[model samples]
Target: MKSIIFIETTKSGSSREAIKTADRLGFYTVLFTERPNFMAKREEFPDVHFMKLCDLSDMNVLQKEVKALILKGIEVSAIVSYVDPHSYTACTLADHFNLNHFSTEGMKNIQNKIQSRELLKNSSVTPEYWTVVTKAECKELEPKIKNKFPLVMKSPKSTGSKDVYKVGNLIEYRKRYNTLSTLYENQPILIEEYLPEPQYLVEVVVHKGKVHIMAIIKQDIQYNRRFIVMGYKLLLNPGVRFSNGLMKAIKEIVAKHGLETGPCHLELRRKGNQWKLIEINARISGAGMNNMIKAAYGINLVEEMLKMALGNDPDLTPKFQKNVYMQYVTVEKKGTLEKVTGKRKALASQGVVEVYVKPRKGSVITPPLSMGHRYAYVTAVGNTAIEAEANAKKAAAEIQFWIKESPKEKITTVIQ
Candidate 1:
């Protein structure tokens, strides 16, 4: 049987779904991961043919592992990863094996914010940005951007909304810069002009330089300490004129950056009458995106991406189309999760299709500092966007998290 290798996977979401898809397609599936806890639960992944523990950060270690598999007569068909820097690692390994996948340069362009922004600096889609490596550089650039308050500061490699900060003034800018510099240590920080509300996520599939706009999701974001995506609504029909303009922009961006094949998701914001590029990722979006897309369009994106990795043309035709909405469950305070109640009720609610809750009992939970803080989600469908959204929210409200506040300890001093 032909084999496919997965470099690392998210605890939940598209990555895990891809592995299951590959197994169902009858390919020998092998997983290399650093999480022993995940590997220990072998019974959970019965479809996986092999699971090996390895230092995923070391390419030499991965090379040796693949060589051992080859010695055992495993015919490797494709190497895939949904997370980065493992995504970049997978592309490099595909090149080493002469397999079909995205170019490492293209992946890097998508992975590195600074590189992508610099490459598309002259384009209309490019947002105004400045790169800083130190507090001195931030100070030097501050005067130039004095009037541009409410800018965003972030590490080039940050993901999942971590290490991204929105500052309203010079004091906030310097404070955020110090925090990021301390976290990254000599890595360049990108400060970009903050785009206002009405952002959209474009899920794209490109094959042999042809771009396919599979789904356009309108995002509902809540601004707290970080940008928290509270919900998503898939636009079943985004109109021909709007779709055409978005397609034209996406095509130009993909061609200019050389992302000739594979799956990519772009985050764009509406500025006046035009859409501006926020960032691009070289993988299908995580966090129930696959589920949302499948519910809305009846297209399995993860399966399609797996097929593409194995040098097969994907079937992108929509089997059906409907309005779908997803709402995330989050807490407003920090405490220990004692229990989660109402899953059955939420699942049984009208129009609710899926209800998933993460975080085991006694796990610490906090408000949205990043996407990880979201512990549960409810997906629902309707004949209209408002109906879908209302149904999702109604179901989400049925589920509740019971958390216990941590007790404060009193300190005692002894005098001798």
Candidate 2:
């Protein structure tokens, strides 16, 4: 039996997908994470093991620990991780074990958003309307600059939609900038032109210099300027199509930066007839975007990564599903206790595949819905794209958010 190691195997959809892939590959997969306690929470799966690694940034210590694990009779063949910070650790471990892996340079280029953007610019694949801002110097920036308004401000190092802001004017830009700068303190932010078309994300699984599209997902956010993503659905939209030119640009950028192998999630924006490159991710994205893409496309990217790590080529074919949509339930306001209506009835709706609800009736909710803050999520599939999207929306609408209005927004007392 082959043994594979996954770094940062926390309790996430990615972790669940890894387990599924391990089962499919029939390998003894060991997962290393910061939270060893996560092992106690999950139900048992045969041939799956969980280990813990502390402080992914501590390279030397991690090396010594891996050596110790090897000495302790753990037969490890390949190293893989679904998280950004852990990609470097995976590369290091793979090199130490002499397993087929992406080079250290590749990992760095993809993981560092700044480096990735620079590479894109050098290859002429990036758009012309993007600017990087350091926290200190950002105060001097004119948010209403004639050049780059109606823009997106994003954290270079963030994963998912943690601190992204869409600013229309100078006031909004400065307000959001100060809020983020005060919270994060000196981290770099990217301000780029906000493209008007639907946002499309492509998941690429690169093995031995060959790249395959694992999935294509279209994202939906709560509002235009909100950083938090409301949900994402599989891309079956007619408008969503990749061209040969864009593919060549991506390959050139990846090759130039040495992003030779691994799972990458690249975001692209379409303006009129031209496709512009957004930032690329070194690792898999949050939500089950990759899995949905695999289920739709029949290209098992996780399984391919596993095979690549084991020095094998993946079998690829065009496996495409008809239509699918995934959505998240977000609260409208903050309150102590609330009631969710029509949950059981919604679950029985046609084409509803799965539903995950985190908050009970009385759970506290936060604004700008994030990865773990979502009260619930729904994934649906159907014969038509519109049907699938409607099913997800219907299911989400059933879950009511009965929140009490905050004192600041209250107008009743003032009028009285």
lDDT of each: 0.86, 0.67
Cα-based TM-score, every candidate: 0.95, 0.83
In the range 54-140, model 1's lDDT, one tens digit per residue, is 998788999899989999999999999987667778988888888856666777788877888988998988888999997789889
Task: Please report the TM-score between candidate 1 and the true structure.
Answer: 0.95
RMSD of each: 5.8, 5.2
Q: Which portions of model 2 show Cα errors greater than 4 Å?
A: 23-26, 36-48, 122-124, 129-136, 139-147, 236-242, 335-347, 359-363, 369-371, 400-416
Model 1 residue 250 distance off true place after TM-score fit, in angstroms:
1.0
The total of clashing pairs for model 2 equals: 1
